[model samples]
Target chain A: MPELRVDGVTKRFDKVLAVDNASFTASPGRILGLLGPNGAGKTTTIRMIAYITVPDTGQVLFGDKQVGPWSQKQMGYLPEERGLYRKMKVGEQLTYFGELKGLSHSEAVKRVKHWLDRFDASDWYGRKTNELSKGMQQKVQFVTAVLHDPELLILDEPFVGLDPINAEVLQDVIMELKEAGRTILFASHRMEQVEQLCDDICLISQGKIVVNGELREIKKSFGRNTILLDFEGPDGFLDDLESRQLVRINVRSKSHAEIRLLNDTRPRVVLDEALRHTHEISRFELVEPSMREIFVTAVTAQQGAEAIEV
Target chain B: MTNNIFIVAKYEFLKRVKTKWFVITTLLGPMALIAFIAIIGYVSISSLTSDDKTVAVLDATGILFDGLNDEDGQITFVVSNMPEDSVRKAVIRGVFDGYLLLDDQIISGSGEATYFSKDGGGASFFSRKLRNLVRSTVEERRLLEQHVPPEVFEILNARVDVNMVKLSDTGETTGGTEAFAVVGFIMGFLIYIAMFVYGTVVMQGVMQEKINRVVEIIVSSVRPFDLLMGKVLGIGAMGLLQMTFWAILIMAGVLLSGTVVAAFLDPATLNLPASASQDELLAAADFTIPSIEPAVFIWFVAFFLLGYLLYASLFSAIGSSVEQQQDAQSLMLPVMLPIILSIVFLQPLIEAPNSTLAIVLSMIPFTSPISMVVRFAITDIPFWEVSLSFLILVGSFIGSIWVASRIYRVGILMYGKKASFADLIRWARLS
Candidate 1:
């Protein structure tokens, strides 16, 4: 099992600090979701880990060894802007990439066939990559990234341009790879996918990591203070709850609402008050915050604090 | 790293060489040029050898007729007591190819002669021949009237040619300097064009890879420098291969054509005119082909390689620094300037190869790859200068590769924005 540790790595592109004091540890067999908005230093950090871009400060280590060309060989990276030789035949392109990754010629040929078959892309073997659909090309790119059986897989926005069915196929493959004990760092904007796939999460904003921890632990630390509620009653209860400051309505609809309980108010107290106003409370339950909410809250909070100082 | 370079180079070479266009161009390019030259030669020769014509002469001075015998049976003079205007009308009516008007003051050097013909430009060869015949006959008659002996007049009228031979300090004469200059100009120009053509191929290859976004995937395993070298060397090797193919093909074509032409023409046509000893004929035949020196050829290859390496690296660097094909033009201009300058200045170099301007330009690495070859062919450049030029060219080549590698390391990964010269310099320095 290999562990990828990024320690206080800083990278500056001209005057912009693309990655500032970014640090995280992805343990073996765990999927680490690198969560960030656009230009949040996600790609830069990944590039550093892949040894494509060197950090200005600090280091990235694989297990006990520092990441260099030797360690780079053990990693597979799918860049955000994925590309392949459009004029090249699918099988030849894969074989060429395999050879570049230091695989023997015969092994590269064999693995190309195996991966194509596994992806149900054997029919694409003789076709040029440009002849395939974008989703098919994505599948081919994925196979190219992992053809070497690398120990560490870094995928940046891998789900982009993928249709739902192909996305599901990729998700299953990533899960299968994770189960086989590969250390995977996945960056994506799809919070639902990250929530389902990742065991650990690192949320970066403005080139800095604001949230980094085990996914369950991070969620637990946020506390289960929000409730999922369903009711058939007057909608005036939402404003009434807001007026009392007993709960804040995070999401609302005609018959259902998700509310965050105030620090001093108890969920039961809010529920009792809601029952008095509504016709019936069919369902009410405390729930963990979604990754989207956590991400938005963390980034907004950081921005607000920074706003005050500026 | 070397292994990666070799692998990349092998791929580049194969990708280009296996293309149908490459094969067709390599095999047919020279053949087309040869065919074009042959057609032009055939047209010129046929026009020159067109049927001999009878010319009506209105020689007011009757003394001109007996002396103006036809030279080489190309023209037959028909004396007619007709007005110049009537002779011109006769010419237009196709009674004769042309007519000549000569007045009574012919021998006293106040004579005016005019040739009348339907086609102005087409009569140039015949006009020259007719003019020579009249001038020589008049001069011979003048010398005889001055009591000069006929033998002395004939001697005075004989044509003389200067034999130019290169002499060493020991008074040893080297024949065929004329052939050497011609061959040199041809070889030097070929190299100039080859460097421009194939060096662009290298640049375009880099640009293609950049445009395709394949550089990122490739630079991951192989170093950027390795990839760059592989591409440059691979493309350069392809250039060499194509050049060798053209050379052999052209050589075979020349040999085969020569034999076919010989077999077609009568042996008597090729035999020397019955006039002189065998030595003069052999000497005239010697002008047919210049003996190629083995040393000069070896130096040609060396210089070609050096020049290709120097320019190709610069071209690759420019390719990497640009964002699009349109951007390449502005960047390519500077690299192309020197090559164009070399060609523009090549005439002066060939005319006076030992001139100071020629020597200095040939010594500069940028221009030397071409100018030096021109100088080497016509004249004997000092051994030291040739070696020094070679050394400087190699040094610049290495320097270019170094600079190119730096730019390549940074540029291949950069996208979106077009990079300026300042940015390229910064990248070369920082990376």
Candidate 2:
């Protein structure tokens, strides 16, 4: 059974279709990355999934069962609000929240201590949340989301406000949860992180999914004929190369250029053209389109259709 | 559902109590109240002992010196040396609480005496004393005009021991000063304090939860109704606990001040004329001890809880509807107006404890908790109105809970939107 299935969901905030006809499913041991720009219905979708909100016109199912019938204890949701009791002790707050989510008091306490120590924050257990920095608070929030050992974890901006080290630490834990067969879904706009961590990706834009698929399959279908040529010269190579039948170059820097080739293009022709163009072609390598490129390409291309006269 | 309600309530109560602000404020509120009462008591006793009064004697008649001498207390009498302009300046500079101007020039025509004091004769004991002195002086002059000498006049005083006898239309006896009115005021003030404190606490708790976004997290766990009712009842318990502490404190105060209590019951402390006998004193007792029966207190608890729940629901609803403190202020006046109106209009009830208006108002559930408690305290408040008003009060409480719960549900999620009176009406109708 699918770990979670949000089918035919439609949520409108008044006249604004915040989540319009959106649907997706993720199986257990899989991470479904919900990606979108700011105000792109990512959080709203997560909110609906977390049971923080109800969808106006559809059903959210947990495994084979409808989520509406499930107890709050079944799912762990980290809202974008990113809060704990500001004046409460971190350890105490975690245990309280954990217990409220249906863990026994001792179990909650034990889980809190275990997670706190895992993050090397055992010394800060007694300290108030407000005493911690933003990154520390984010760590606390992450622990709160998982402390009850929920089968499903829905995190909205889970790695927000964390340092690079801590973000990676959280990413590792997320991967570990996947391996332990927990259905994990997190929202992020950083496409690289989603690409690295997500098994299935659902990219939402303007309250609609622009892309939804297995991450590896999506990357494979994106094609590998694209080349990033970083070299020294007058840089007219891009303009000259733009006239080619299957070449598309998007935004260039002073020393580097990215090129996407059409399905009909040959890699040998591109290599021949590259060698002929500039002798100072220090790094000319064929590369699969990065998720960042794919995101910018998809979102920009999507936005182009809705452009006004202005 | 019952389990959920109690679970929600227990957590809400524990959570609020554990809050730093609540803990600090709880400690601070009683400390401040006690310190304030003590400071007021100390200041009052000190002022009475200090005798911080400056008297200006014009000596226009130059006849009275005993006026300035209160044998036990310290009073400083300043004989006017400068013109009246200087006295005006001194008064404006707050150099004196007031100054007495004895212009005895008008003494010839029926011994008219003009005593000038700033803000004259407004409840101060000094003004009372000043009036007494002027009257005595005028009486002496009249006695002199007659054949009676000063020594004979002083010896043959006509001090009458006036006794009060209230007669109904059918000639029934009654106590003077309306002992029930005092009971009414005491109960009214207690209810006022309880309602105000608990309402404020409910408001602040809701505001804190909304501002902290803890409501969002908790709503995920529990229903909005559960949260709202839990909060209302939880704070209600806290308020009752505080009132209990106050009751204990008052009993302690009454115990420690045994001498003062003795003065209250002692017939010797009446301070009437020396010639009155104990039998006459007994016949002329001006005040009666208020009998407190268990029934009055039972009604008090019933009405207090019902009335508190009624208004507390509205308070919580108001608090949940608004985002900011300033926004909450606009919502307050409408909710507070009824209780305030009850306090204001039923004030006469405190004066005429068993008047028709007091009885009627006490029967009205809105005003019953306070007005009824007073009537129930001294008089025999009718059993019918007690049961009827209590029934209505409970009905109103249930009705308000329904309305307040509806308001809380929609209002909790409403942000950057000002809910007007009209909107509330619509919300109520819709819900």
Best candidate, lDDT: 1
Tens-place lDDT digits, model 1, residues A183-224: 999998888889999999999988999999999998988888
- The DockQ for candidate 1, computed on C-alphas, is 0.47
lDDT of 2 by residue, B62-83 (tens): 6554444544443456667577
Local accuracy of candidate 2 as per-residue lDDT tens digits, A1-310: 2479989898886578999888888889999988877888887788677676688888888877766515467777777786677877898788777766767778888999999999989987999899999899888888878887778888877877888898888888988989989998878766667878889989887888888889888878887867888877667656776776567775478888888876568767766776777667788778788777677666766777553111
TM-score of each: 0.85, 0.80
Predicted model with the maximum TM-score: 1
Summing lDDT over every window of 10 consecutive residues in candidate 2 chain A, give the lowest-scoring window: A301-310
The CAPRI quality class of candidate 1 comes to: acceptable
Clash pairs of candidate 2? Answer: none
lDDT for each residue of candidate 1 in B142-186, tens digit (9 for 90 to 100): 776788877886677687967778654435344677767777877
